[model samples]
Target chain A: MVQIPKTPGPSSPAPRPVPTSADVARLAGVSRATVSYVLNNTTSVRISEPTRRRVHEAAKELGYVPHAAARSLRAGHSRLVLMPAPDFPVGPLYSRFISELQWALGRLDYTVVQFGSVGLHGDEAVRAWAELRPVAVLVPGAGLGPQGVEVLKGSGARAVVTLGSEPVDGAHALLMDHEAVGHCAGSHLHDRGRRRIGVVVPREHGLESFSLPRLKGVRDALHGTTATLTELPLAYAEDSAARLAASWRDLDLDAVFAYNDEYAMLLMRALQDEGVRVPEEVAVIGADDLMLGRLLRPRLSTVHIELPSGRDLAELVDRAVRDPAAAPETHKVLGATVIHRDSS
Target chain B: MVQIPKTPGPSSPAPRPVPTSADVARLAGVSRATVSYVLNNTTSVRISEPTRRRVHEAAKELGYVPHAAARSLRAGHSRLVLMPAPDFPVGPLYSRFISELQWALGRLDYTVVQFGSVGLHGDEAVRAWAELRPVAVLVPGAGLGPQGVEVLKGSGARAVVTLGSEPVDGAHALLMDHEAVGHCAGSHLHDRGRRRIGVVVPREHGLESFSLPRLKGVRDALHGTTATLTELPLAYAEDSAARLAASWRDLDLDAVFAYNDEYAMLLMRALQDEGVRVPEEVAVIGADDLMLGRLLRPRLSTVHIELPSGRDLAELVDRAVRDPAAAPETHKVLGATVIHRDSS
Candidate 1:
């Protein structure tokens, strides 16, 4: 391939001119209001079918699209569905769900906007979100409360959906029982004849909502049996995992249920580096059965979490928005199953 | 241990009332407009210091925050920097960059919104983005052209930044220089006395912009050497990597650049499963040096990329927005370095 010579000038010659709605209206032999009505699809404006067709064709030729902010201002709400910002590095499970959610929302003619509501909690975050007058708000965190929900509703947010371990009052809840995932992992290890199990709890700020509940579930599952539970605080950092694995003998754990596959892979590799045999010395189990985990040496054993499809959730949100008085519904959004592999 | 009976009643009592802007305004003995001006720091609205302080105190007592969407609409642009949606199952490199970008934009009072612009390419995507009237738009894909840039600019977008191998004519380009990344990996393998290298190109949709350019860079660097370049199409899927690794001997490649560490790890584990010796027989290198790469047995060598801080870019966009006539500036925001380890 020939290398293109670097140009010895400014980035571009000049900015290109943009055609306006007025230009399209003029081309279609209609008023600017007619063009706006056709483009914005305002049901209030009655225009002839031929005029609408002409305006649309003219818009296509001129490449004229309605301005979003202007349209939003007129409608008093945006077609944007604001989601709670991810506070931690998203893993495959959350990433895939988010991607699917965006696709689903896009299909519903709603733009998905992810906002990091880390520092702003409860009502402060809700008020901030409400200002956008988003048609819908999907809060993945439990930071939002009943008051927050009311604030969002007052601001014209038609639907409020919260995805967490518990339900929120007055909001559609997509409960992802973290305890069930932990119970699945602990039971799987116990059934495999491993009595001493270590459950990794992420020592990160945002993950507490998930890790804490999961730890409780593990303890609950090991209640009557001789199986023991050990809590291991693991960070996402490699050095942290390495330090933890280097002194694994001191911990005296036979099998470990790493919080998720990402952390599981990290700890497993760290253990291998320290000359510890996996599955033999210490069976490793993880959540979120990612493809990469299976590609590892002594393929990673994981709890496969099947999350509710974004299409289903999106349809529900649309339905809820259309009928705000509809009774709030709760659904189990995440269900886990153990995928047995070489590691466990 | 006792099982907590699942309560059929409400999980928690209704939350206390949240203070609104009107409440703050009333408490401060000021108009709602003045409260908005003081809270949002609108330059056009002149308020006395005493009144501003009173308003601030009232808002603090009430825990009121100015609505983001309302403030944005009144200001004629949302303090939102929209980025093209991320392809899910994102590796550490992109994840780190996104996190950094969000933090940076937050510092500049701009909420970073990740919009999935999939299936919506070029001007169509730009039009969709323009509807939000984001102060700036950052397209991370190669599909955005001059027309797309112009559409954003026409819709009052103050700064349009495109991150890719090639620069868009009307937008300020932050060139990633993928060729350099590829060259760095290829030359390092060559220096290690390996020839007949195969570069793994991801068949994933969003990655083509980076992977294709990296392949060209590898070919360009190996022009005058005995090292012949082999193109290997690899998907992120496990079965795909396994299929490619199953016929590894026929390919006869000594060293392979597996695009990024995620893919490198995938192929490395697959090759090892098929009894191929790494480095000793087939040296392996991946881009986007991640912590997990070093934890692998024999470790994985990788190319590390330093992205321009999101804070710095946010500041630049803010500056550009303040002065729309400021001459557009192109920035080389991506820097690369090789991290040597056991695999290569």
Candidate 2:
């Protein structure tokens, strides 16, 4: 048949239609099942090497990428690991930890998709996550409840890891153990003969999940000691630090655990501005052992935290996914130690 | 016919089947079309209020949520905004900005999914993102090329917004103007009678994209000035900072503009440890007006960047998605001004 060429129109170009697996299958002269198997690299059924090569060539020529959603539906699973968004002021330490986790998950060929769970809560949040049908869900903070975990399991998530104070039923736990961090700080301060210790609790909304536990641990550690525990409600603002600095003499705190390195730096600068001598008048210690902390004139003391390497957590997720029938396990992933510096 | 009651037998619990829209349709005594319309709140088709109520009740009773992937396939588009992961050490200011962006997107009824793109590059990264079939892709940093954007568009991405130094062809640009930031700092220091200046270049992997442009800007601003520019290679490590600090006197730089507030604070602390007086021996300035900067002893001088509000970016994304045929536009989303504090 002879085809007649038509003149070009003056209209805008229409969006090109996305090629489907069926089109690839038709081009390769094979069944759609064969296309899916070859594209997804499913090895359950045997196929000739030539057939696979033909299918692949057809897909490449047509620029056909197997729809992730369609493939997920057919396989009853997906390569998505849904991590609930950390809706808080994530410090450098936590940020580094998360990047490492994503890298580790990537090595295992799982796409770590951070689900924006900002306004979503409770079962509603779970239902939203479930709709995406992620193979695994990592719910950080106290975002997911037991019922939510059950919903995720019912929605076909083989692995549900919750990072918080404790594990909810039906989900593996990566307990942060914030209390231990505070206890470590409290005991260290007490050992250094510091009485009247002040602990900074940042007046931020979401950080309370991490801060409150640390405060409790400090209180627990200072129970039988001569050190008097004082709760310092501090906002991460310059004016707030200035105001706290103005009343520093009235509070008369001998030592302070300023939450983390960032807060400690802020408060330390404020105190120094008020002409207070480091360690001589007030000893300051923070957590996270940031590089900047060591650069301070009176090198800032810090609680160095030891978190389970990203590889360990990623491996755990893989194991749980591979063996779904096994009982969900809880692992304490955070350990804390005090690094003495000139400031303390 | 005789009706007989069945007796319960002891057996292990089987995997619970997920409720589908078909189950809801069956229980509601309506067609699957009616169920889909009611559940998705589709406006085209008219359904009776009572019928809609019945469909909703059935869905609620069965604990069914519409599969997001399936719904996207049926609707020919998805409400997903895929943002390439920022693998660099993101400062608190940038972190907060990203969180704001996610929150704003959520407000506009869009789910912002952060795609981890650490190891992936070029066409492979685009293919990975396109497989999810997101309606829009927000390429942060220097992640996407012109060809990559074309690949994404071919894979059905309706809008591609790139945040970087320059706009890629066929993609909307949220130009960060890193060069302007550097120029602002260099000029500010030049005006302060500093004859020589040191600009810290972070030795991090991913940050070069931002740092290099800023360095170029510094060079451009000081092109005809008597001021000489020195590149200070610094890493986000204590040993590196200390090593640089030891050589600070030998460098003989009158002023230093560290990359950002975090790095400036680190370098300033190091200089202080080595008995270098701020603003006397060396003046320092950083970017991003962090609150901690104000609390510093000789407070940190900084370049205050005005990034486009998240709501504005989100609205732009929505507008672009709604009107895809419009010529791709470029928006200068970041502006910079030097905030002269005590350090400078």
Q: Give the i-RMS of model 1 in Å.
A: 8.0
Whole-model lDDT for model 2 versus the true structure?
Answer: 0.85
Give the per-residue lDDT digits (tens) of candidate 2, residues B26-130.
999999999999998999999999999999999888778789999999989899999988756677767777888888898999989998886888888889999
Best by DockQ: 1
Tens-digit lDDT track for model 1 on B233-334? 998888888899999999999999999988998899889988999989899999888877877877899998887776676666776666555566666767
- All candidates: DockQ: 0.29, 0.27
Quality of candidate 2's docking, in CAPRI categories? Answer: acceptable
